[model samples]
Target: MLTNFRRPRTERMRGGGAYVEQRTNSWAALVGFLLGRGYSAPAIAEALADGTSDATVRKMAQRWGLPAWGRKADGFIVIPMKLRDRATIASRAAQEGLGQEEYCRQFLVAGARERGTFRSVVKEGLDL
Candidate 1:
Protein backbone atom coordinates (compact mmCIF):
# COMPACT_ATOMS: atom_id res chain seq x y z
CA MET A 1 0.00 0.00 0.00
CA LEU A 2 1.31 3.48 -0.91
CA THR A 3 1.15 6.07 1.88
CA ASN A 4 0.06 9.64 1.22
CA PHE A 5 2.76 12.25 2.11
CA ARG A 6 1.81 15.85 2.98
CA ARG A 7 3.40 18.66 5.03
CA PRO A 8 1.54 19.92 8.04
CA ARG A 9 0.19 23.51 7.80
CA THR A 10 1.22 25.82 10.61
CA GLU A 11 -1.18 28.34 12.20
CA ARG A 12 0.32 31.18 10.12
CA MET A 13 -0.03 29.23 6.85
CA ARG A 14 -3.62 28.32 7.76
CA GLY A 15 -4.40 32.03 8.04
CA GLY A 16 -3.75 32.42 4.26
CA GLY A 17 -1.06 35.19 4.63
CA ALA A 18 0.97 37.02 7.22
CA TYR A 19 -0.32 40.33 8.52
CA VAL A 20 1.91 43.32 7.81
CA GLU A 21 2.03 46.17 10.30
CA GLN A 22 3.94 49.43 10.53
CA ARG A 23 6.32 49.95 13.39
CA THR A 24 6.01 53.12 15.49
CA ASN A 25 8.98 55.11 16.72
CA SER A 26 8.34 56.89 19.98
CA TRP A 27 11.83 58.40 19.98
CA ALA A 28 11.15 60.12 16.66
CA ALA A 29 7.91 61.56 17.99
CA LEU A 30 9.71 62.87 21.09
CA VAL A 31 12.43 64.43 18.96
CA GLY A 32 9.81 66.07 16.72
CA PHE A 33 8.03 67.48 19.75
CA LEU A 34 11.25 68.90 21.13
CA LEU A 35 12.21 70.37 17.77
CA GLY A 36 8.74 71.86 17.34
CA ARG A 37 9.25 73.54 20.70
CA GLY A 38 12.52 75.12 19.45
CA TYR A 39 14.89 72.68 21.14
CA SER A 40 18.33 72.47 19.52
CA ALA A 41 19.98 69.24 18.37
CA PRO A 42 22.47 69.12 21.21
CA ALA A 43 19.66 69.75 23.64
CA ILE A 44 17.61 66.96 22.15
CA ALA A 45 20.47 64.48 22.38
CA GLU A 46 21.12 65.42 25.97
CA ALA A 47 17.44 65.12 26.81
CA LEU A 48 17.10 61.74 25.13
CA ALA A 49 20.06 60.29 27.07
CA ASP A 50 20.12 57.19 24.86
CA GLY A 51 23.55 57.84 23.36
CA THR A 52 21.96 59.78 20.49
CA SER A 53 24.39 62.32 19.05
CA ASP A 54 23.65 65.90 18.14
CA ALA A 55 24.44 65.09 14.53
CA THR A 56 21.72 62.45 14.47
CA VAL A 57 19.28 64.92 16.01
CA ARG A 58 20.19 67.44 13.32
CA LYS A 59 19.61 64.84 10.60
CA MET A 60 16.17 64.15 12.00
CA ALA A 61 15.47 67.87 12.10
CA GLN A 62 16.49 68.19 8.45
CA ARG A 63 14.13 65.35 7.49
CA TRP A 64 11.29 67.08 9.39
CA GLY A 65 11.78 70.39 7.52
CA LEU A 66 13.01 72.11 10.67
CA PRO A 67 16.10 74.30 10.55
CA ALA A 68 19.11 72.41 11.84
CA TRP A 69 22.05 73.98 13.62
CA GLY A 70 24.75 74.93 11.14
CA ARG A 71 28.32 76.12 11.55
CA LYS A 72 29.27 78.26 14.55
CA ALA A 73 29.57 81.39 12.42
CA ASP A 74 26.09 80.77 10.99
CA GLY A 75 24.51 82.37 14.03
CA PHE A 76 22.42 85.03 12.32
CA ILE A 77 19.92 87.60 13.46
CA VAL A 78 16.84 88.74 11.58
CA ILE A 79 15.81 92.36 11.78
CA PRO A 80 12.43 93.35 10.44
CA MET A 81 12.34 96.69 8.64
CA LYS A 82 10.08 98.59 6.26
CA LEU A 83 10.55 98.10 2.52
CA ARG A 84 11.77 101.71 2.19
CA ASP A 85 14.35 101.19 4.94
CA ARG A 86 15.51 97.98 3.25
CA ALA A 87 15.85 99.79 -0.07
CA THR A 88 17.89 102.53 1.61
CA ILE A 89 20.22 99.96 3.15
CA ALA A 90 20.61 98.22 -0.17
CA SER A 91 21.45 101.53 -1.89
CA ARG A 92 23.99 102.44 0.79
CA ALA A 93 25.56 99.00 0.54
CA ALA A 94 25.80 99.32 -3.24
CA GLN A 95 27.44 102.75 -2.96
CA GLU A 96 29.98 101.30 -0.51
CA GLY A 97 30.63 98.26 -2.75
CA LEU A 98 29.43 95.93 0.01
CA GLY A 99 26.62 93.45 0.34
CA GLN A 100 23.61 94.34 2.47
CA GLU A 101 24.57 91.75 5.10
CA GLU A 102 28.13 93.07 5.42
CA TYR A 103 26.88 96.64 5.59
CA CYS A 104 24.38 95.68 8.30
CA ARG A 105 27.06 93.88 10.30
CA GLN A 106 29.42 96.84 10.09
CA PHE A 107 26.67 99.27 11.01
CA LEU A 108 25.54 97.16 13.97
CA VAL A 109 29.08 96.59 15.26
CA ALA A 110 29.93 100.27 14.98
CA GLY A 111 26.75 101.27 16.75
CA ALA A 112 27.26 98.69 19.48
CA ARG A 113 30.88 99.78 20.03
CA GLU A 114 29.86 103.45 20.17
CA ARG A 115 27.20 102.56 22.72
CA GLY A 116 29.84 100.68 24.81
CA THR A 117 27.86 97.45 24.46
CA PHE A 118 30.29 95.63 22.13
CA ARG A 119 32.86 93.61 24.05
CA SER A 120 35.07 90.93 22.65
CA VAL A 121 38.46 89.37 23.30
CA VAL A 122 39.51 89.87 19.67
CA LYS A 123 38.76 93.46 18.66
CA GLU A 124 39.78 95.84 15.86
CA GLY A 125 39.56 94.59 12.24
CA LEU A 126 38.04 91.29 13.38
CA ASP A 127 34.72 90.15 11.94
CA LEU A 128 32.06 90.41 14.64
Candidate 2:
Protein backbone atom coordinates (compact mmCIF):
# COMPACT_ATOMS: atom_id res chain seq x y z
CA MET A 1 0.00 0.00 0.00
CA LEU A 2 1.15 3.56 -0.63
CA THR A 3 2.00 5.36 2.58
CA ASN A 4 1.05 9.02 2.69
CA PHE A 5 3.37 11.01 0.44
CA ARG A 6 3.97 13.59 3.18
CA ARG A 7 5.78 10.86 5.07
CA PRO A 8 9.55 10.91 4.74
CA ARG A 9 11.40 8.58 2.36
CA THR A 10 13.56 7.34 5.26
CA GLU A 11 11.13 4.48 5.89
CA ARG A 12 11.67 2.92 2.51
CA MET A 13 13.94 0.09 3.70
CA ARG A 14 13.63 -2.00 6.84
CA GLY A 15 16.25 -3.96 8.80
CA GLY A 16 17.65 -7.42 7.83
CA GLY A 17 15.92 -10.84 7.77
CA ALA A 18 13.00 -9.30 5.89
CA TYR A 19 11.47 -10.77 2.76
CA VAL A 20 10.71 -9.42 -0.71
CA GLU A 21 9.31 -5.94 -1.28
CA GLN A 22 7.82 -3.97 -4.12
CA ARG A 23 9.03 -0.55 -5.19
CA THR A 24 8.37 2.18 -7.68
CA ASN A 25 11.02 3.26 -10.10
CA SER A 26 10.90 6.75 -8.61
CA TRP A 27 8.89 9.00 -6.33
CA ALA A 28 6.06 9.08 -8.85
CA ALA A 29 6.35 5.41 -9.76
CA LEU A 30 4.23 4.44 -6.78
CA VAL A 31 1.21 5.89 -8.55
CA GLY A 32 0.65 2.72 -10.52
CA PHE A 33 1.34 0.53 -7.52
CA LEU A 34 -1.38 2.15 -5.42
CA LEU A 35 -3.89 2.43 -8.23
CA GLY A 36 -3.80 -1.32 -8.67
CA ARG A 37 -4.96 -1.61 -5.09
CA GLY A 38 -8.36 -0.20 -6.16
CA TYR A 39 -7.49 3.44 -6.54
CA SER A 40 -9.29 5.11 -9.45
CA ALA A 41 -7.70 3.87 -12.68
CA PRO A 42 -8.24 7.16 -14.47
CA ALA A 43 -6.76 9.23 -11.67
CA ILE A 44 -3.77 6.91 -11.40
CA ALA A 45 -3.42 6.75 -15.17
CA GLU A 46 -3.16 10.52 -15.25
CA ALA A 47 -0.17 10.40 -12.90
CA LEU A 48 1.84 7.25 -13.58
CA ALA A 49 4.46 6.71 -16.30
CA ASP A 50 4.13 2.91 -16.39
CA GLY A 51 0.38 3.42 -16.64
CA THR A 52 0.41 4.05 -20.38
CA SER A 53 -1.94 1.08 -20.80
CA ASP A 54 -4.85 -0.24 -18.76
CA ALA A 55 -3.01 -3.55 -18.71
CA THR A 56 -0.42 -2.01 -16.45
CA VAL A 57 -3.06 -1.18 -13.86
CA ARG A 58 -4.57 -4.63 -14.29
CA LYS A 59 -1.24 -6.30 -13.72
CA MET A 60 -0.68 -4.22 -10.64
CA ALA A 61 -4.02 -5.31 -9.25
CA GLN A 62 -3.20 -8.90 -10.03
CA ARG A 63 -0.05 -8.49 -8.00
CA TRP A 64 -1.50 -6.61 -5.03
CA GLY A 65 -1.35 -7.86 -1.38
CA LEU A 66 1.57 -10.13 -2.20
CA PRO A 67 4.94 -10.00 -0.48
CA ALA A 68 7.09 -7.04 -1.36
CA TRP A 69 10.15 -9.14 -2.26
CA GLY A 70 9.06 -12.76 -2.51
CA ARG A 71 6.64 -14.06 -5.12
CA LYS A 72 3.70 -16.21 -4.19
CA ALA A 73 2.64 -19.40 -5.92
CA ASP A 74 1.18 -17.07 -8.52
CA GLY A 75 4.47 -15.18 -8.84
CA PHE A 76 3.33 -11.96 -7.21
CA ILE A 77 5.51 -9.75 -5.02
CA VAL A 78 5.45 -10.68 -1.31
CA ILE A 79 7.63 -8.99 1.32
CA PRO A 80 8.34 -10.67 4.62
CA MET A 81 6.31 -9.78 7.71
CA LYS A 82 9.43 -8.64 9.58
CA LEU A 83 10.27 -6.15 6.84
CA ARG A 84 6.71 -4.94 6.62
CA ASP A 85 6.57 -4.30 10.34
CA ARG A 86 9.79 -2.30 10.28
CA ALA A 87 8.64 -0.30 7.28
CA THR A 88 5.32 0.50 8.95
CA ILE A 89 7.03 1.54 12.13
CA ALA A 90 9.41 3.81 10.29
CA SER A 91 6.65 5.20 8.15
CA ARG A 92 4.68 6.15 11.24
CA ALA A 93 7.75 7.89 12.64
CA ALA A 94 8.17 9.87 9.46
CA GLN A 95 4.53 10.80 9.52
CA GLU A 96 5.05 11.94 13.08
CA GLY A 97 7.82 14.33 11.97
CA LEU A 98 10.91 12.24 12.64
CA GLY A 99 13.97 12.88 10.47
CA GLN A 100 15.98 10.31 8.52
CA GLU A 101 18.24 9.23 11.37
CA GLU A 102 15.33 9.04 13.76
CA TYR A 103 13.38 6.92 11.33
CA CYS A 104 16.20 4.38 11.08
CA ARG A 105 16.83 4.38 14.82
CA GLN A 106 13.17 3.66 15.55
CA PHE A 107 13.18 0.58 13.34
CA LEU A 108 16.79 -0.55 13.23
CA VAL A 109 18.44 -0.76 16.61
CA ALA A 110 21.72 -2.56 15.67
CA GLY A 111 22.09 -2.88 11.93
CA ALA A 112 24.72 -1.54 9.54
CA ARG A 113 22.82 1.72 9.19
CA GLU A 114 23.17 2.11 12.95
CA ARG A 115 26.73 0.75 13.10
CA GLY A 116 27.96 3.95 11.48
CA THR A 117 24.91 6.14 11.85
CA PHE A 118 25.00 6.12 8.06
CA ARG A 119 21.31 6.50 7.41
CA SER A 120 21.40 10.25 7.88
CA VAL A 121 24.64 10.87 5.97
CA VAL A 122 23.30 12.58 2.91
CA LYS A 123 25.89 13.18 0.16
CA GLU A 124 25.94 16.92 0.77
CA GLY A 125 27.81 16.36 4.03
CA LEU A 126 30.61 14.29 2.43
CA ASP A 127 32.68 17.42 1.54
CA LEU A 128 34.07 15.63 -1.48
Candidate 3:
Protein backbone atom coordinates (compact mmCIF):
# COMPACT_ATOMS: atom_id res chain seq x y z
CA MET A 1 0.00 0.00 0.00
CA LEU A 2 1.20 3.54 -0.82
CA THR A 3 0.71 6.54 1.49
CA ASN A 4 -0.44 9.91 0.05
CA PHE A 5 1.60 13.00 0.83
CA ARG A 6 1.61 16.68 -0.18
CA ARG A 7 4.41 19.06 -1.08
CA PRO A 8 5.23 21.78 1.45
CA ARG A 9 3.56 25.17 0.87
CA THR A 10 6.88 26.80 -0.02
CA GLU A 11 7.62 24.03 -2.50
CA ARG A 12 4.30 24.64 -4.28
CA MET A 13 5.09 28.22 -5.27
CA ARG A 14 6.30 29.36 -8.77
CA GLY A 15 9.44 27.31 -8.36
CA GLY A 16 10.97 25.15 -5.67
CA GLY A 17 12.69 27.41 -3.14
CA ALA A 18 16.34 26.47 -3.48
CA TYR A 19 17.20 27.09 -7.13
CA VAL A 20 14.65 29.83 -7.94
CA GLU A 21 14.91 31.74 -4.69
CA GLN A 22 18.67 32.04 -4.90
CA ARG A 23 18.60 33.54 -8.36
CA THR A 24 15.57 35.76 -7.74
CA ASN A 25 16.99 37.05 -4.48
CA SER A 26 20.31 37.90 -6.09
CA TRP A 27 18.65 39.79 -8.92
CA ALA A 28 16.38 41.74 -6.57
CA ALA A 29 19.30 42.63 -4.35
CA LEU A 30 21.43 43.84 -7.24
CA VAL A 31 18.59 45.98 -8.60
CA GLY A 32 17.89 47.44 -5.19
CA PHE A 33 21.55 48.15 -4.56
CA LEU A 34 21.97 49.91 -7.88
CA LEU A 35 18.85 52.00 -7.32
CA GLY A 36 19.96 52.96 -3.84
CA ARG A 37 23.26 54.15 -5.27
CA GLY A 38 21.41 56.66 -7.43
CA TYR A 39 21.98 54.62 -10.55
CA SER A 40 19.28 54.98 -13.16
CA ALA A 41 17.92 51.72 -14.54
CA PRO A 42 19.35 52.60 -17.93
CA ALA A 43 22.71 53.25 -16.32
CA ILE A 44 22.55 49.94 -14.48
CA ALA A 45 21.60 48.13 -17.67
CA GLU A 46 24.46 49.78 -19.48
CA ALA A 47 26.87 48.84 -16.71
CA LEU A 48 25.71 45.25 -16.94
CA ALA A 49 26.09 45.33 -20.75
CA ASP A 50 23.47 42.54 -20.81
CA GLY A 51 21.95 43.45 -24.18
CA THR A 52 18.77 44.80 -22.57
CA SER A 53 17.55 48.09 -24.03
CA ASP A 54 17.65 51.26 -21.95
CA ALA A 55 13.95 51.73 -22.60
CA THR A 56 13.20 48.30 -21.13
CA VAL A 57 15.21 49.12 -18.01
CA ARG A 58 13.47 52.48 -17.78
CA LYS A 59 10.06 50.80 -17.88
CA MET A 60 11.17 48.31 -15.26
CA ALA A 61 12.34 51.14 -13.00
CA GLN A 62 8.97 52.86 -13.44
CA ARG A 63 7.10 49.63 -12.72
CA TRP A 64 9.11 49.30 -9.52
CA GLY A 65 8.24 52.94 -8.66
CA LEU A 66 11.91 53.81 -8.23
CA PRO A 67 12.61 57.50 -7.78
CA ALA A 68 14.63 59.19 -10.60
CA TRP A 69 16.01 62.15 -8.69
CA GLY A 70 14.01 64.83 -10.48
CA ARG A 71 12.51 63.04 -13.45
CA LYS A 72 8.91 62.37 -14.33
CA ALA A 73 8.09 58.66 -14.36
CA ASP A 74 5.97 58.85 -17.51
CA GLY A 75 8.94 60.17 -19.54
CA PHE A 76 7.48 63.61 -20.02
CA ILE A 77 9.88 66.45 -20.78
CA VAL A 78 10.55 68.73 -17.78
CA ILE A 79 10.69 72.39 -18.61
CA PRO A 80 13.45 74.48 -17.03
CA MET A 81 12.20 77.41 -15.02
CA LYS A 82 14.24 80.46 -14.12
CA LEU A 83 14.97 81.41 -10.49
CA ARG A 84 12.17 83.98 -10.19
CA ASP A 85 9.69 81.68 -11.92
CA ARG A 86 10.73 78.82 -9.64
CA ALA A 87 10.21 80.99 -6.56
CA THR A 88 6.72 81.87 -7.80
CA ILE A 89 5.97 78.21 -8.37
CA ALA A 90 7.15 77.37 -4.87
CA SER A 91 4.93 80.06 -3.38
CA ARG A 92 1.86 78.92 -5.32
CA ALA A 93 2.45 75.24 -4.63
CA ALA A 94 2.98 75.98 -0.91
CA GLN A 95 -0.30 77.87 -0.80
CA GLU A 96 -2.05 74.92 -2.47
CA GLY A 97 -0.32 72.41 -0.19
CA LEU A 98 1.08 70.44 -3.12
CA GLY A 99 4.56 69.53 -4.23
CA GLN A 100 6.11 71.77 -6.86
CA GLU A 101 6.38 68.95 -9.34
CA GLU A 102 2.73 67.99 -8.91
CA TYR A 103 1.66 71.61 -9.18
CA CYS A 104 3.64 71.98 -12.38
CA ARG A 105 2.08 68.85 -13.85
CA GLN A 106 -1.45 70.11 -13.15
CA PHE A 107 -0.58 73.54 -14.53
CA LEU A 108 0.67 71.94 -17.73
CA VAL A 109 -2.49 69.87 -18.05
CA ALA A 110 -4.62 72.97 -17.67
CA GLY A 111 -2.54 74.74 -20.31
CA ALA A 112 -2.98 71.78 -22.62
CA ARG A 113 -6.75 72.24 -22.37
CA GLU A 114 -6.47 75.87 -23.45
CA ARG A 115 -4.21 74.87 -26.36
CA GLY A 116 -6.85 72.33 -27.56
CA THR A 117 -4.37 69.43 -27.20
CA PHE A 118 -6.39 67.94 -24.39
CA ARG A 119 -9.66 68.13 -26.34
CA SER A 120 -8.03 66.78 -29.50
CA VAL A 121 -6.57 63.84 -27.63
CA VAL A 122 -9.95 63.11 -26.04
CA LYS A 123 -11.65 63.27 -29.44
CA GLU A 124 -9.13 60.75 -30.75
CA GLY A 125 -10.39 58.29 -28.09
CA LEU A 126 -7.18 58.17 -26.15
CA ASP A 127 -6.91 58.34 -22.37
CA LEU A 128 -4.50 60.99 -21.12
Among these predicted structures, which one has the highest TM-score? 1
Q: Whole-model lDDT for model 1 versus the true structure?
A: 0.67
TM-score of each candidate structure, all chains considered together = 0.42, 0.24, 0.36
Candidate 2, which segments miss by more than 4 Å at Cα?
1-24, 27-29, 36-38, 49-51, 65-128
Give all candidates' CA lDDT scores: 0.67, 0.48, 0.61
The per-prediction tally of clashing pairs is 0, 12, 0
Collision count of model 1: 0
Between candidates 1 and 3, the one scoring higher on TM-score is: 1
Please give the distance, in angstroms, between residue 103's alpha carbon in candidate 2 and its true position after superposition: 34
Writing each residue's lDDT as its tens digit, candidate 1 over 7-124 gives: 2221232235565322135557777766765566776677766577999888867777976545654555556688988999999999999999899998887767764555454487
Q: Whose lDDT is greatest here? A: 1
Candidate 3 off by > 4 Å: 1-73, 116-128
Model 1 poorest 10 in a row by lDDT: 1-10
Greater TM-score among 2 and 3 belongs to 3
RMSD of model 3, in Å?
17.3
Candidate 2, residue 33: lDDT? 51
Candidate 2 per-residue lDDT, tens place, 25-92, comes to 45334643554344554445544443245555556655664323233232222233576666776688
